[model samples]
Target: MKIAIFGPSRRVGVVVDNDVVDINGAYAKYVADTTDTARSTAAAALEVPADLNSFIEQGAGALAGAKAALAHLSANSITTGLDGERLVFALDSVRLHAPIDGKSRVFAALANFADHMQAAADNTASGSDKATLSRLVSGGPKYFIKDPRVVSADGDDLQFPRRTDLLDYEAEVAVVLGKRGKDIAADDFGSYIYGYTLVNDWSIRDNVSFGPDFQYSKNFDGSATVGPWIVVDEGLDPQDIDVEARVNGEVRQSGNTKSMIHSFAALGEYLSRDSTLFPGDLISGGTPKGTAVDSSIRDSEGGFEDDSAFLNPGDVVEISSRAIGSVTNTVTGTRTGKK
Candidate 1:
């Protein structure tokens, strides 16, 4: 089942075709219409959390309850109306937020795709160190922590940081953890995963080459654009899904998850070797080979010049996949100053 946080209140909703079933709202209605003793029983049987983060943290029991509630609603003919605005609202009517806002530790893989690594290699100067590239090619997935505050929802505007001229977009697939585990093994990866979501790992290219730290280049406010909704991992295969990205309706990045240098299980094992991965922690699989910086608009010094390839203030970036839906964000004017 696809789950989402919708509307101004950010309530938990289940995406059903072209509409969303208000799972939390339905449970609340059940409690309101039942007797004192029956209300307690109903609440326990249909325990849908108020938000997506809390829902995920509740583990398997919460998911089961939510599915039960959805089944109950469907059986009773309580689905949305013809206009898709009754108990279930039209998918476009309500606002959608990042599935795990302020509730997840965001970690993203760097150059996990062989083609992306080749692109980065081609763009770098001959005098540059190849040690990091060599390590990524042979070693496990290279990752960096991103601030959750940078996460923005679908349809939200991405703020162009004034500090940099080369803003780029990376379309990636994000793994959402359901259970907590330390030193998790590769074979047991499925037991710990909850679902998958779309992630636009926005980057500032200027800050990247100057130093080794990725936080400065990637963690600016509204840098991580995530979610139309999260598709549960029950029947979905993250290893072989199609991933694509478009800027202002023009196709920019086109690739598949099968091209990943490191598998999802390998990334999970590497991440959990010495630390615990809790529910709601997001692990973004690296993007494919078609970023704006990979275009042929580079300057003579191999840096991106102010050109058509780099993201501008009015550009609209839409990142999509076959499993998880699209996450579209428009670029807005930047605030001038260090953020």
Candidate 2:
């Protein structure tokens, strides 16, 4: 089942066919009708919460309740709830929010795909002995934590940073953890997996931060663009998702997670060793080859020395997959970063 937070109020919803069922409203009504009237509100909040993060934290009980709520709605033709809360809504009538609110940390894999690293190096490296993704991966998995403050949702306008002219995009699959686990064993990812969302790792190529971490280069107002919703990991093979990145209508990056240098289990084990991994904590698999700064595209189209062209003010960057769904966002706000 697909789970989402929708509309201006940010209520938790379940995607069924072409409509979104308000989970809280449906579950509350179920509680009131099935058990006791006094237990309705509290029961719905605890069993199938209004926040996606809270819902995940509730674990299997919440999952069962959410499914039961959907079943309850399907059994009847309910339109509105006891307090005039909407039971079901047209999908297009509401706005999609990030699967999790801005409370969870987003950990992203860096240089996990050899082709992506090759593209970055091919554009800038001039030395005879240049660094490669393979060389960078002789040790282990590398990752960077995104600033949760800048977590933008699908269809939201990207806040173009006012500091750099070279804006780039990295398309990836972000995994949402199901439960809290510290020092997760590499082979034990079967139970910890929860769901997946698409992420576009927007970067300002010119902004330099100390060391390899893109601390300053990545922490803009809209760098971590995620969601339409999260697809539960029931049928997906996390290590084998096919992802594609496009600018407007043109393909910029295309690769499968099978190309990843480090396995998902290994990355999970490493990430959890230092700190506890919780439900709703997003771990983004690294992007594939072909960013805006790709050398081949730059050489083919002679608009700039670095690449074809940096992200303009009105370009649409779309990151999509067959299983997880798509995230489409327009480059909006100021172009002061280009100035």
Candidate 3:
């Protein structure tokens, strides 16, 4: 089930045959029709809410119920809920939102990719410190918290910030947690994962000089571009996925999840050490190299001087994975006209 939370109403939906199914409404209708209860609609909403985050909180039963509801819709040709609520829609007919919004926390790993870490080491480290990035994973995955307020959805416009001229895009695979757990073992990560999604970890290249902190470079209110829909966890390997990024349709970054110095299991275990992992909380597992700054030093064809290297007004930045899906956000004009 590729589940999504979409549009102005923020309804939870399931993608089937390239169309969006209002799973919550369908589930409500299913519950109302199957059982003898006048308040079945209200009951269904409580049992299996229409919002993705709330729905996720219901855990496996709601997941199973929603799947059965979708199956019921298909089996019976159901088009609308009991109160005439829309139960199905064309994929492009409505807006797509980040699966979890305001309902969860986002912790993003830094330099999870060996190639990316190597690139960073090559640029900044000297002597024995250069290119020896194995120690990163040896110490386990490290992350930084991203302000959830900055999360923008697929097809949304990312407003270019006026503070820096070096806006960049990073393509990453984000793990969406399902069950809350503390000090979970690496082997149990599969049970706790709900699904996977894509995230463009937007950055301000020039702002790093002021950082030991990332707030100035990474959390500019529109930096977290996430989702098309979450590809539900159904026993798939999170450590073996593809990652790609394109700017204005030109492929700029490409790597696989297998290249991660730290695997999903390791990262999940690291995150749950003392804190609770909750449903809808995202673990943005860092990005692969070929970011603008990486290319500013590594690209063989002198790609650094290219105006298309960094985001500018009207550039569409797309982050993708074959297993999860893709998300594209167009970079629009400044938040203010300061620049």
Candidate 4:
């Protein structure tokens, strides 16, 4: 029951390859060819599962119904032209967009990992006063909200800002919210999730500090690199997966989700309380240890200063998770005022 949205930009069409069904096409075909009623969201096209947001709008029932329909199709050996074709397009061919576009708000955790915080501390000249994941909860849930414009899909190039020489990568697994819920109970957190994906939170080391507004550092354009795809049916516990960050095929970061201070369910429930969460909202649960920023593999001998080694043009970044798959992107730099 792995579903995907394909096409250019916001005009993506839905596809369920296993069933040879096109949710977008089926909706149109049914409205014109059958007696089925059109749905405001893509959920009504149960014969074909649509986007993750559609799952959010329809809830758990939509998933069950779509599976039943897909089962019926699989048994009959249904074949659509898009079956194997679209899947091939997904592999290194088409540029993947954020699985769900225009998500209202992105909830990001800060210092959610003791090792990550320690790495952050190591990178900067600051003393060890920096909090780690295990000790972060001594206060409240340390979190941040990312500007939606900063979000970009996989296979796209991120522009390295020339103003700052330090560009770092934080590998994390992000959850896609499936349903709208406020004050969600911990027991019912699973029902609110659609699936998971890998996130590479690109950062500007200099801009990030205890300033009046920390959002400026994390919310730059293309700072949010998500997708490759969302696993709609792969019943995975986000906190149980392993995450890795590699640069030019060299593993720079490696850690397991078991080290997360707050579990995925807890973060979701905490954010939803007293606040409304809509379909397509992204919740990134932070990264683990061995991040590139904390490693000593930079080309400091040459003019490539240690800070300049953060991320330069022509560098490739690969972020992967055991369950959500991998997403790789190339980095390119541009002078700020240059036309």
Candidate 4: residue 270 lDDT (0-100): 87
Error of 3 at 312 (Å): 1.7
Model 4: per-residue Cα lDDT over 45-160, one tens digit each: 54334554654566556556555544544465543322233212333344446766665577888878878666645544433233332255456567888776567777888888
Clashes of 3: 0
Report clashes for each candidate as comma-separated counts: 0, 0, 0, 3
Clashing pairs in 4: 56-178, 113-133, 114-133
Most TM-score-accurate candidate: 2
lDDT of 3 by residue, 1-339 (tens): 788887689988888877898877888888887888888778778877888778887877777888888888888999998889788999999888888868598888877887887675564433433333445545667778778866899988888888877789999998888877899999988888888888888988663632367566888877888898888845667888889999889998999888887778888899899988888899888888888776654333322344346778878888887788888888988634223
Each model's lDDT = 0.78, 0.80, 0.80, 0.66
Q: Would you estimate the TM-scores of all the predictions?
A: 0.88, 0.91, 0.89, 0.79
Worst 10 residues of 2 by lDDT: 295-304
lDDT, candidate 3, at 55: 81
Indicate whether candidate 2 or candidate 4 has the larger lDDT: 2
Cα deviation at 124, candidate 4, in Å, is 5.3
Q: Could you give the candidate ranking by lDDT, starting with the highest?
A: 2, 3, 1, 4
